[model samples]
Target: MTEPQAREIIENYLEGYNLFDVAGMLSCLHPAVVFENVTDGSVTLRTNGKDAFEAQATKALALFMERNQSILAICLNADCARVDIKYFAISAIDWPNGLKAGAILQLTGQSVFTFRDGLIASIQDIS
Candidate 1:
């Protein structure tokens, strides 16, 4: 894949994600896609393959009443793309940890995307 191809794919994925459109997001991924979420140097979530990714994404749909991910910066090579992100969301329901519904969540993070067969093969989100 070319750098421009990677950028377009990433943008498409982000568009789907912001809209909570799981199917659209999946369209940019390889069938064997691997996904991970890293927080403070530890892996908080990992999903292997599209089925697992779909399950996770579907579950996440209910956690936020609103969500958006804005790309701050992005660089892409044939093999991969790295993006800095500003994320904002509002909780849809109370959490066990005392986060109440309507609470605002905002954070900055980085996401790495690797490509295979002209599609995203892996995504690692770090914060």
Candidate 2:
């Protein structure tokens, strides 16, 4: 797809995500969408298809009281777009990892997106 088209799709998805709106996010993804999360050079999570992705997104919706990912930059290639983002959030509750409720979390990350039929087909998030 073209750059602007791809960017608009990505921005739409992110807008849904930042609002914890799973339905809106899923509207921008292909039916067979695949999602992966990588941390410290290792893949920590993988979800296939829109259903699985929706489930994960729903679960994550409760992880933070407020969260946002501000796009820092976006670069386009033949069939993929990479987005650099700054993530900030306030924990909604205590976590097993010792992150307590009300704690502030911040990080920088990149998300690589690929599209199919004008919708996002795959996503790899790295941090």
Candidate 3:
């Protein structure tokens, strides 16, 4: 796909995620996909295929009592992209993890996405 088309596809995918629409988010991934989440100093959550990835997403959703994740900006390169996301994730209702009310945890992270045939073939993230 063209760069603009890929950007739109990614934007839509991000929008779907912020809305907690799992199905919508999964639609952007290829059948044979590799998703890597590198957080907490090099441990990776790797999933093969869309189904596996969806399962991981579901687990993450279950952990949150409330969450609102937003994409601040997106920059697309040749077959790669970076997105700045802002999010508010709460583990449980009325359980404060030292976060203030209405506080947005600003995350300036980047993910490299490789597309094959207009679908995401690989996604590697770092914060």
Candidate 4:
């Protein structure tokens, strides 16, 4: 893929995230896609394949009463992209020891995307 094509894919994925559109997000990923999520320098979640990703995405989306991902910067080559985002969300349910329902959360994060066959093969998110 060209650099712009890679960037567009990333942008579309981000848009899906902001919209809580699991199908839209999955469309940008390869069938065997891998996803890793890190928070505070620790890996919080990991999943492989479209089915696993869809399950996680659905669960994660349900926890957010409102969510938005605002892209701060994007850098891309032919096969890789890095997206910096300002993320905001409000909890829809209470956690065991985390935020309560309706609590607002904000974080800055980066998602590194790897592409193969014109689709995202993997994504590693760090915040």
Candidate 5:
């Protein structure tokens, strides 16, 4: 895909994520899409295939009462793009460490997306 098209696909996916629209997000991914989440330089979660990814997304959404992502920047090259985002979420649970329900949390992260046939084939998230 062209650079603009590839970027648009990523943008759409992020928009879906902010909206908690599972179907919309899934529409941008390939059937065999792989999603990896890394924390502290270690792989924390990995979901393979569209079905698995959908389940993971649903579970994540359920943990937050509200969630949003603002795109800080995007760099596109060929069929890949690096997206920097400022993510915010309000937890639905009260944690033992004093984080209470409805408390907001903010994080800055980057997602690397690889596209195949105009759909996202793989995504790796680092925060």
Candidate 6:
């Protein structure tokens, strides 16, 4: 796909993610896609395939009562894209101590995605 096409795909995926629509977000990933997260300064999360990614999302959805994410920007190349996202979270279902009853934590993060055949083959998140 061209650079423009890759940008559009990434933009659409970001929009879906902001909505917390797991299925919509998953549609952008290839069947054999792997997603990794490096939040704790270490790459710990590894979702080997789409199914595994969905399982993680399921657990997250059940854990958080409310969530909102917004895309700050997107940089796209021929076969890759990076998106900056700002998010707000309210984990009412499992609120830990030190946080108020309905605490909103604002977070800024970035996601890098490598595309193959117009679909995401790999995604790595840095927060």
Q: Write the per-residue lDDT of candidate 2 for residues 42-118, one digit (tens) a residue.
A: 99999999999999999999889999988999999878999998999999999999999999999999999999999
Which candidate achieves the best lDDT against the true structure?
Answer: 1
Ranking by lDDT: 1, 2, 5, 4, 6, 3
Off by over 4 Å in 3: 93-106
Comparing candidate 2 with candidate 4, which one achieves the higher lDDT?
A: 2
lDDT of 1: 0.97
State the displacement of the C-alpha of residue 127, model 4, in Å, after optimal TM-score superposition.
0.7
lDDT of the candidates, in the order given = 0.97, 0.95, 0.74, 0.91, 0.92, 0.80
Error of 1 at 96 (Å): 2.2
Question: Which digits, one per residue and each the tens of the lDDT, describe model 6 over residues 39-117?
Answer: 8689978999899988887677665567776779988777877889887887665365567646677899988989987
The list of candidate 2 runs beyond 4 A from truth reads none
Q: Clash totals for all models, in order? A: 0, 0, 0, 0, 0, 0
Better of 2 and 4 by TM-score: 2
Better of 1 and 3 by TM-score: 1
- lDDT: which is higher, 5 or 6? 5
Model 4 compared with the native: what TM-score? 0.94
How well does candidate 4 score on lDDT at residue 83? 88
After superposition on all C-alphas, the RMSD of every candidate to the true structure, in Å, is 0.7, 0.7, 3.4, 1.1, 1.4, 2.1
Colliding residue pairs in candidate 1? none
Model 5, residue pairs in steric clash: none
Off by over 4 Å in 4: none
Cα displacement (Å) at residue 94, model 3: 11
Report the lDDT tens digits of candidate 4 across residue range 1-127.
Answer: 9988898888899889989999999999999999999988888999999999999999898798999988899888768888898999999999998779999999999989999999999999999
Clashing pairs in 6: none
lDDT of 4 at 77: 73
lDDT of 3 by residue, 10-105 (tens): 777777777778888888988998999888668467899998999998877655556665667777777777766665665542234575544445
